[model samples]
Target: MLTEKQIATETHKQKSKFVTVIHPEKLIATKTTEENNDNTFLISWLFLIGSLMFLLDGFIELSEGLSIHVLLHITASGVFTIASALFIPKK
Candidate 1:
Protein backbone atom coordinates (compact mmCIF):
# COMPACT_ATOMS: atom_id res chain seq x y z
CA MET A 1 0.00 0.00 0.00
CA LEU A 2 1.56 3.29 -1.14
CA THR A 3 1.27 6.23 1.24
CA GLU A 4 -0.46 9.42 0.07
CA LYS A 5 2.80 11.42 0.03
CA GLN A 6 4.60 8.70 -1.87
CA ILE A 7 1.76 8.39 -4.35
CA ALA A 8 1.73 12.12 -4.91
CA THR A 9 5.49 12.20 -5.44
CA GLU A 10 5.30 9.30 -7.90
CA THR A 11 2.47 10.98 -9.78
CA HIS A 12 4.37 14.22 -9.96
CA LYS A 13 7.48 12.50 -11.29
CA GLN A 14 5.46 10.70 -13.98
CA LYS A 15 3.62 13.89 -14.99
CA SER A 16 6.83 15.90 -15.12
CA LYS A 17 8.19 13.48 -17.71
CA PHE A 18 5.46 14.59 -20.15
CA VAL A 19 5.26 18.27 -19.17
CA THR A 20 7.69 21.07 -19.90
CA VAL A 21 8.06 24.01 -17.55
CA ILE A 22 9.37 27.10 -19.22
CA HIS A 23 10.34 30.03 -17.08
CA PRO A 24 8.33 33.22 -17.64
CA GLU A 25 11.49 35.13 -18.56
CA LYS A 26 12.53 32.48 -21.07
CA LEU A 27 9.10 32.51 -22.73
CA ILE A 28 9.11 36.29 -23.01
CA ALA A 29 12.67 36.27 -24.31
CA THR A 30 11.77 33.88 -27.14
CA LYS A 31 8.86 35.85 -28.58
CA THR A 32 8.94 36.13 -32.40
CA THR A 33 7.52 39.66 -32.46
CA GLU A 34 8.41 42.37 -29.99
CA GLU A 35 5.54 44.74 -29.40
CA ASN A 36 6.16 48.28 -28.18
CA ASN A 37 2.55 49.09 -27.41
CA ASP A 38 2.81 49.74 -23.69
CA ASN A 39 0.77 52.97 -23.59
CA THR A 40 -2.65 51.73 -24.60
CA PHE A 41 -4.31 52.62 -21.31
CA LEU A 42 -2.51 55.92 -21.08
CA ILE A 43 -3.54 56.97 -24.56
CA SER A 44 -7.08 55.82 -24.03
CA TRP A 45 -7.40 57.81 -20.83
CA LEU A 46 -5.86 60.86 -22.46
CA PHE A 47 -8.26 60.68 -25.38
CA LEU A 48 -11.22 60.19 -23.07
CA ILE A 49 -10.27 63.22 -21.01
CA GLY A 50 -9.50 65.27 -24.10
CA SER A 51 -12.90 64.46 -25.54
CA LEU A 52 -14.60 65.60 -22.36
CA MET A 53 -12.60 68.82 -22.25
CA PHE A 54 -13.28 69.56 -25.90
CA LEU A 55 -16.98 69.04 -25.37
CA LEU A 56 -16.98 71.33 -22.38
CA ASP A 57 -14.96 73.98 -24.15
CA GLY A 58 -17.32 73.76 -27.09
CA PHE A 59 -20.30 74.37 -24.83
CA ILE A 60 -18.66 77.36 -23.20
CA GLU A 61 -17.77 78.73 -26.61
CA LEU A 62 -21.37 78.23 -27.75
CA SER A 63 -22.43 80.74 -25.04
CA GLU A 64 -19.67 83.21 -25.99
CA GLY A 65 -18.94 82.91 -29.72
CA LEU A 66 -19.10 80.65 -32.83
CA SER A 67 -20.36 77.11 -33.55
CA ILE A 68 -16.97 76.18 -35.06
CA HIS A 69 -15.54 75.01 -31.74
CA VAL A 70 -18.51 72.71 -31.22
CA LEU A 71 -18.02 71.15 -34.64
CA LEU A 72 -14.34 70.70 -33.92
CA HIS A 73 -15.18 69.07 -30.60
CA ILE A 74 -17.59 66.66 -32.25
CA THR A 75 -14.91 65.68 -34.76
CA ALA A 76 -12.32 65.28 -32.03
CA SER A 77 -14.73 63.13 -30.00
CA GLY A 78 -15.24 60.82 -32.99
CA VAL A 79 -11.50 60.53 -33.57
CA PHE A 80 -10.85 59.68 -29.91
CA THR A 81 -13.63 57.09 -29.98
CA ILE A 82 -11.99 55.34 -32.93
CA ALA A 83 -8.50 55.62 -31.45
CA SER A 84 -9.58 53.96 -28.21
CA ALA A 85 -11.41 51.24 -30.15
CA LEU A 86 -8.16 50.22 -31.86
CA PHE A 87 -6.54 49.31 -28.53
CA ILE A 88 -9.38 47.05 -27.33
CA PRO A 89 -8.50 43.35 -27.20
CA LYS A 90 -10.41 40.83 -29.34
CA LYS A 91 -11.79 37.60 -27.96
Candidate 2:
Protein backbone atom coordinates (compact mmCIF):
# COMPACT_ATOMS: atom_id res chain seq x y z
CA MET A 1 0.00 0.00 0.00
CA LEU A 2 1.19 3.48 -0.84
CA THR A 3 2.11 5.81 2.03
CA GLU A 4 0.06 9.00 2.49
CA LYS A 5 2.96 11.19 1.40
CA GLN A 6 3.56 9.07 -1.71
CA ILE A 7 -0.14 9.20 -2.64
CA ALA A 8 -0.19 12.99 -2.22
CA THR A 9 2.92 13.31 -4.40
CA GLU A 10 1.38 11.17 -7.14
CA THR A 11 -1.84 13.23 -7.02
CA HIS A 12 0.11 16.48 -7.34
CA LYS A 13 2.02 15.13 -10.33
CA GLN A 14 -1.19 14.08 -12.07
CA LYS A 15 -2.81 17.49 -11.46
CA SER A 16 0.23 19.33 -12.81
CA LYS A 17 0.05 17.31 -16.06
CA PHE A 18 -3.12 19.25 -17.12
CA VAL A 19 -2.06 22.63 -15.68
CA THR A 20 -1.04 25.49 -18.00
CA VAL A 21 0.98 28.41 -16.72
CA ILE A 22 0.12 31.40 -18.84
CA HIS A 23 2.28 34.52 -18.82
CA PRO A 24 0.97 37.69 -17.13
CA GLU A 25 0.94 39.52 -20.44
CA LYS A 26 -1.15 36.73 -22.00
CA LEU A 27 -3.65 36.92 -19.13
CA ILE A 28 -3.90 40.72 -19.43
CA ALA A 29 -4.66 40.36 -23.13
CA THR A 30 -7.85 38.43 -22.39
CA LYS A 31 -11.12 40.37 -22.14
CA THR A 32 -13.67 39.34 -19.49
CA THR A 33 -17.19 40.68 -20.22
CA GLU A 34 -18.65 38.94 -17.18
CA GLU A 35 -16.42 40.98 -14.86
CA ASN A 36 -17.84 44.27 -16.19
CA ASN A 37 -21.44 43.09 -15.72
CA ASP A 38 -20.66 41.89 -12.19
CA ASN A 39 -19.11 45.28 -11.35
CA THR A 40 -22.18 47.12 -12.65
CA PHE A 41 -24.48 44.90 -10.60
CA LEU A 42 -22.47 45.53 -7.42
CA ILE A 43 -22.50 49.29 -7.94
CA SER A 44 -26.26 49.36 -8.52
CA TRP A 45 -26.90 47.42 -5.33
CA LEU A 46 -24.68 49.77 -3.32
CA PHE A 47 -26.48 52.82 -4.66
CA LEU A 48 -29.87 51.28 -3.88
CA ILE A 49 -28.87 50.56 -0.29
CA GLY A 50 -27.54 54.07 0.19
CA SER A 51 -30.74 55.62 -1.17
CA LEU A 52 -32.79 53.48 1.20
CA MET A 53 -30.68 54.67 4.16
CA PHE A 54 -31.13 58.29 3.09
CA LEU A 55 -34.90 57.86 2.97
CA LEU A 56 -34.92 56.13 6.36
CA ASP A 57 -32.91 58.96 7.88
CA GLY A 58 -35.45 61.49 6.62
CA PHE A 59 -38.28 59.47 8.11
CA ILE A 60 -36.52 59.28 11.47
CA GLU A 61 -35.94 63.04 11.50
CA LEU A 62 -39.62 63.71 10.74
CA SER A 63 -41.08 61.13 13.12
CA GLU A 64 -38.72 61.54 16.11
CA GLY A 65 -38.38 65.37 15.99
CA LEU A 66 -35.28 67.24 14.73
CA SER A 67 -32.94 67.29 17.68
CA ILE A 68 -29.21 67.98 17.19
CA HIS A 69 -28.47 64.28 17.29
CA VAL A 70 -31.09 63.48 14.69
CA LEU A 71 -29.86 66.33 12.49
CA LEU A 72 -26.30 64.97 12.58
CA HIS A 73 -27.45 61.47 11.74
CA ILE A 74 -29.53 62.74 8.82
CA THR A 75 -26.68 64.88 7.54
CA ALA A 76 -24.17 62.04 7.70
CA SER A 77 -26.54 59.59 6.07
CA GLY A 78 -27.38 62.07 3.29
CA VAL A 79 -23.70 62.67 2.54
CA PHE A 80 -22.98 58.96 2.33
CA THR A 81 -26.04 58.35 0.14
CA ILE A 82 -25.03 61.07 -2.32
CA ALA A 83 -21.46 59.81 -2.40
CA SER A 84 -22.59 56.28 -3.15
CA ALA A 85 -24.95 57.46 -5.90
CA LEU A 86 -22.18 59.47 -7.51
CA PHE A 87 -19.46 56.83 -7.25
CA ILE A 88 -21.39 53.69 -8.15
CA PRO A 89 -21.50 52.62 -11.80
CA LYS A 90 -24.83 52.49 -13.68
CA LYS A 91 -26.03 49.61 -15.80
lDDT of 2 by residue, 7-89 (tens): 99999998888757789999888769888778877977778697777769676676867677777777777777777777766
Off by over 4 Å in 1: 1-38, 66-91
TM-score of 2: 0.48
Candidate 1 lDDT over 47-73, as tens digits, reads 767766766666676677667756787
Quote the positional error of residue 77 for candidate 1 in Å.
Answer: 3.9
Best by TM-score: 2
RMSD of each: 10.3, 8.7
- Predicted structure 1, TM vs. truth: 0.38
| lDDT on C-alpha atoms for all candidate structures | 0.67, 0.78
How big is the positional error of residue 5 in model 2, measured in Å on the Cα after superposition? Answer: 56
Model 1: how far residue 56 lies from native, Å: 0.8
